[model samples]
Target: MPIPDDLHIQEAATLERKAFAAMESGHLAFRQGKISAMELFLLADKWELAEEALRCLEKTAQSS
Candidate 1:
């Protein structure tokens, strides 16, 4: 069965949010002195998120 486009979009959005949350948690852990915590964060980033984060950061820097 073919999934509807709307559902696909919704699912992608949900996954992206989860990935972002994981990355954020990893960063927090890293800041708090947990080096190994970054692995989980990167795993999420690998799911088409790290590029987005990097782009956003770059844009912010450029605008500043």
Candidate 2:
């Protein structure tokens, strides 16, 4: 496989940061009761943040 250049690495990092932000937003929405379980999961899935989403879900469940 070809090695990624600086620009490619930076772009990937930016995308990951955006995904993390969206996942955090989804968790915030969940805590605020503004979104249902289905909506929260969908939001994470839509943003390609399943791991973060699952982390948020599990954290919430543990808190409750």
Candidate 3:
């Protein structure tokens, strides 16, 4: 039942990545004034994708 390292996300990795990307996008949306501060304040608490989302944000900020 062990999935090979190459087969990672054979279960939920795909969903996790998509979730992380989506949540990170929320931050950008808020930063660009697309979403209100109060909106992020409220929805941020509901986001469970912190670490990965931050990682994505860091990369994006670095690239720009």
On residues 1-64, what C-alpha lDDT tens digit does candidate 1 reach at each position?
Answer: 6555555455556656776777777777777877665575566548566457555545544454
**Over 4 Å off in model 1, which ranges?**
37-64
Find the 10 residues in a row with the least total lDDT in model 2: 2-11
Q: What lDDT would candidate 3 get against the real structure?
A: 0.61
lDDT of 2: 0.69
Models 1 onward score TM values of 0.56, 0.64, 0.48
Worst 10 residues of 1 by lDDT: 55-64
Cα lDDT, all candidates: 0.61, 0.69, 0.61
Screening candidate 2 with a backbone cut-off below 3 angstroms (N, C-alpha, C), the clashing residue pairs are: none
Cα error, candidate 3, residue 17 (Å): 0.4
For candidate 1, what is the TM-score? Answer: 0.56
The lowest-lDDT stretch of 10 consecutive residues in candidate 3 is: 3-12
